[model samples]
Target: MNKTDRLLAIVLELQRKGVLRAEDMAAKFETSTRTIYRDIQALSEAGVPIVGAPGLGYSLMEGYFLPPVSFTAGEAVALMIGTDFVEHKFDSDYRTKAQSAREKIEAILPESVSQETNRVRTTIRLLVTGETYNSGREKEGLEALRRAILDKRKVRFHYSKNIPGADGNRHSVRDVAPYGLVFAQGSWILVAYCDLRQELRHFRLSRMSDLTLLEDSFTFPTDFNLQDHKPADDRRVLVRVQVHPDIADKVKGAGSFFMTQMEDHEEGLMATFHVRQPEELLHWVLGWGADVVVLEPESLRNRVREEAAKMLKGY
Candidate 1:
């Protein structure tokens, strides 16, 4: 960051955090302590009310705040897009807040900048895919989970996994201490400490039902940071399928998340997928019928045969 931008950011950080040590500021801005000292001196000379002590850190004077800042047209457009995303992706409560935020941003922008931002935004669109994106039930579940995460409370719900358990049952009841909410691949996933399993697990909001907030509360782990948490990757199964050339473009357009690679083949198009289990691609393969053929993993082929036989019986 330039000196001017860094100076403004340091002041904003002080205002937000109340106080910060020189070492802490140096680390945050990724600069040397000497640079931070110089910046603080510069701010002091410019009439910024920064008070520092020998041991304690530097702090902004009580009741001091920076005046309204200006935004370039590009910056304005970026903010507008962010608000648009929040309005569409979040629940009713946050949707209202995003609308208010967008209004405030537009009110502050110059008329020319506002017009330019609106024109640019019109050329870009955020499309919603899948049934779970804006479903009322999904929205309600997300909102409930959000409240649970913020309140440090436990929640109870019945979850339906794609694969059945050893008992041939796909549904199970769970009581978990909510840790965080993640939005990935057009789905809302709740990362929590599962009471039954005694470990952290990810539950898709769309597969959850009868979600209820419990009065029982739990303490969030101080060491656990949602931003740094990396879930184990379990998609080990490799699936290869051959698609007829006639529908190759359509299959590519589908944009299946599991698909890792696709290439033209002598027979047709060779498409490869990575999944947690072979069953995850069952219905997807069946959707193409004769146009698609599973090349390996004999288990998936046998299962497909059985399912096709069952369909013949129904006819």
Candidate 2:
């Protein structure tokens, strides 16, 4: 192997096994002992902290690991380009952490790797979100919710829910213990237990105000599974929907959106889906416009007709 290849291999060997005898490396690389000694000298001159003793062979200094040296120019461009893209779309508060991680990655990389990284950083570009990003408020709530979820601990936060037909008197405010945070439709939602309802519930983090983390903690029962915590089967009503033939490929796939077996129909393709609430799916069906037909479960058909009539009245 050439000098650069030999040096990189030696560093890798030291890292893998924690130590290597010069004689052993020389034999592995098919180089003479004298040449290996010269390579070691060159490596030390280049700031590599290689530790060794006459009888013990050679080992890298503790904590001073070397990175691979054979990275190509094209590869570096790819990394910097990708990192730049990620740097923007990532949450604002997490951006700094991402940058720090980038620095560590650049540090461990060999010159070719580092150079390629820089080339991409300098040559490639990314579109920033334009809008000011402040993850401060969102970050704290998420952090608290994350910790609670991972450790199976609980956190308390104040929240509000709007009451129907009550105008200003409709606002209800209270505290809850957060159990899990879920990402849906580009928003963050906290699933928690309502001390009032005595059941698990989901709340939009963005909608919550005066959020504060509580010191008190609660344990999730070994029986409590997050996957099974959605509104219970009682609230999940089965409604059949007919998907138009043209839209079948688009709508009839696996998801909470539609139930299985999207069969072809005279009017359209028909299937069933479980919905806990009406408003969300109502909009979804409308988004498909006239292409989808809401079938069976008279409640759903009535709901669609009622909503449609309301839309016409509004217009």
Winning model by TM-score: 1
Per-residue alpha-carbon lDDT of candidate 1 for residues 1-315, written as tens digits (9 for 90 to 100): 999999999999999999899999999999999999999999999999999988999999998999998888899989888988888778899999999999999999999988888898899888865644335667889888898888888999999875621335488999999999888887788899999999999988888899999999999988899999999988899999999999998999996988999999778999999888888898899999999999978988898998899999999
lDDT, candidate 1, equals 0.90
Compared with the true structure, model 2 gives a TM-score of: 0.53
- Model 1: which ten-residue window has the lowest total lDDT? 160-169
lDDT of 2: 0.68
| Segments in model 2 whose C-alpha atoms lie over 4 Å from true places | 1-93, 110-140, 143-171, 215-235, 249-261, 265-267, 277-280
Q: Over the stretch 43-107, how does candidate 2's per-residue lDDT look in tens digits?
A: 89999999888888898888885654544667656655566654654444456777776676677
lDDT of 2 at 231: 50
- Candidate lDDT scores, in order, read 0.90, 0.68
Candidate 1 scores a C-alpha RMSD against the true structure in Å of 2.9
RMSD of 2: 9.5
